[model samples]
Target: MLQLCRDASGAPLAPQGSVVCIGAFDGVHLGHRALLARARERAAALGARTAALSFEPIPREFFARGTPVPRIDDARGKIVQLAAAGADLLLLLRFDAALAAMSPEAFVEQVLVARLGAREVWIGADFRFGHARRGDPVLLRELGARLGFGVEVFPEFLVDGERVRSSGIRAHLAAGDFDAAARLLGRPFMIGGHVVRGQQLGRKLGYPTANFRLGRRTSPVDGIFAVRVHGIGPVPHAAVASLGVRPTVNGTEPLLEAHLFDFDGDLYGRRLDVEFVAKLRDEEKFSDLDAMVRQIDLDAAQARSLLGVPEARPAGACA
Candidate 1:
């Protein structure tokens, strides 16, 4: 079972001599994977379990109020990814004021030394923790030496000569460069949600769609996209997707809708995972329904071509 440690509350659990990596791991990008790999390698060598420690409602979210932040994945998704990466234990530490107020020494002594029994610690060069972000790689090394633990700080991971980072991935997604973002993420960017009812606007336009209510924290890629829908059959199907507040329809809440290339079925309440492939265009308003239909036709053609769906029908065709 996965263990989630929240705040320095109650009695500390006895350490099992684990090799751990610590980070926000927002996107679980290549950098995160590299750190995890190192941790896993060290754990195997030392005969210790591999674990990842991260915070929930990330520090930035706590500081940002309710403003929409560019999050590649939510806490649940982070845990899933970490577990898939061979984490024997996953700790979802609740980032409250009390935990945030711990001094560097206290954090290392209480969390790392006492609770986690960290035999080996791995992190990126830029990793920081403790009160006021005073804990750097050097500080961790110094503390490790005193605490009788090993510390490994890895150099930044690079892709195409550019350092792969969560911020860089967010920037690429914001600009609708899903392909570039995927290259850094080591897989296509995917958003999973349960299908929900919509205003039937797509149906009226001759293109029925599966509407999805994204999680509270999702990336800020608000635009039309070429996507692939998974969880329906042997292979994912090509799709055209829209993400954002529907300005033309005067919609308030953000919505994610995907129209499959050649699929016809009721998908209400079904879980859908949409893999973003390419950005077709930015969302725009049309003067009339006819104009909107025409633009959607063009968007569908572009999405199909980008997704390599050879038999994709035109926009107005029935699925």
Candidate 2:
């Protein structure tokens, strides 16, 4: 069982001591996985539990204020990925004003030492934290020495001689290069959420869709896509998805709507994962409802072709 905890001040979670890995872990990308692996390895050797410490809202997002910060993975995805990475406990601290105001020494003392009872702490080589982002590995090691814990900085995780970065992955997704994004992510780029009820506009347009809200400041990927819908059955279903604010509908919030091909059933409240296979086109505004539906027909046809699904034949037509 993995424990999800917030708040820097709390009853010590690991009285037996723990190996702690700290980062924003926004995407839980390949680089973040390496750090988690190291933490788990060290914890096993020391007979301590593995704890992953990250922040909710991410520090950058919290500081961005009115500006929307693109996220590679949403909040739920981050927690799910972290737990699946073998963390015994997850500390998702709230990145509020109080947490941001804490000094480096105080953070180490309160969160790492007093709260988690960290025996060994791990972080990425360039990781920084605390007030004004002044804390570095050097400062952490010095604090560890006085606080009776060991500190180790994992070497920069790289791919093909270049460092892996969340920002880089975001760029790939933004440009609709899912192959490049997945190469660094170690898995297909996906967004998962419980299906939510929408305005039923798609159904009225002759394509009912399962809608998933992108519950973040902004989504890294947008536009129409050739995709697969997973977690509904034994095999993933081919689908066409749209991600963006519905400009034609006068909407202002980002939403992901996936219409599974040749399928019909209720998906409300069921969690599903939409995996991007290819970028079909960018979202566009149409002159009228009929025009919008016309483009959707094209999008669905293109998506089906990309996904290797045969197009639906006219009723009673030759095979």
Candidate 3:
């Protein structure tokens, strides 16, 4: 099992010593994975465990206040990816006012030294932490010298000579270039969550869907997508997904509604991962229910063709 801690101060987690990697790690993109892999290598060399330190609500999100900064992944997604990336222990700090005010020295002493007993700490070239973003590699080295830890800087990760960055991935997603985004992510961009009950309007429209609410998350992609729904069966199910506020219905919150072709099993509470394959169209307001349904028919047909789904199940079969 992967051990997780949220508080900044607590009993020592790795008394035997650990190699720690720290970052916001919003997307766990290719660059972030490189840093984690370096930590694993260092941990193995020193006979220590691997630990990853990150922040929830990511510092930028906390500082952004009411402004929603687009994120490639959410908290649950982060946890899942971090573990898969070889983090034996996860320190997901709550980034509140108290933590924001902590000094770089204090963070190293309390979190890295006292809590994790870190023998070596790995960080990306542009990493920053502590109050006012004062923490840097130089400051970290100074603290490490006095705190009995060593600091290593992971080189900037690149693919095809292009640097991998969260911002670049976001830009690709915004532009609906999913292929470019996936190159940086090292996998197809996806969103996973438990199905939630919506207004059931899709069912009334002859398209039953499994809904996932975005809550406070600001997603980079918003539109009709050709997607593959995972966790439904042995193979992914080809589907058409809508991610946005339903303008026609006057809905406000961002919701992901996936209508799986030929699927009729109950999915109200099942966890599903919707993998975006291609953007079909942007969300638009229609004049009435009839018009909206017509547009939806077109969108679904386009998605089915793009995903190479031989043919959609019988009409109203999913309903």
**Which candidate should be chosen as best, given lDDT against the real structure?**
3
- In candidate 2, where is summed lDDT lowest over 10 consecutive residues? 212-221
**Each model's C-alpha lDDT?**
0.84, 0.91, 0.91
After superposition, candidate 2 runs with Cα above 4 Å error = none
Where does candidate 1 clash, by residue pair?
none
TM-score for candidate 3, residues paired by index = 0.96
Which candidate comes out best when scored by TM-score?
2
TM-score of each: 0.91, 0.96, 0.96
lDDT computed for candidate 1? 0.84
Better of 1 and 2 by lDDT: 2
Model 3 regions lying over 4 Å from their true place: 313-319
* lDDT for each residue of candidate 3 in 84-109, tens digit (9 for 90 to 100): 99999999999999999999888899
The candidate, 1 or 3, that scores higher on lDDT is 3
Give all candidate RMSDs, comma-separated: 2.9, 1.3, 2.4
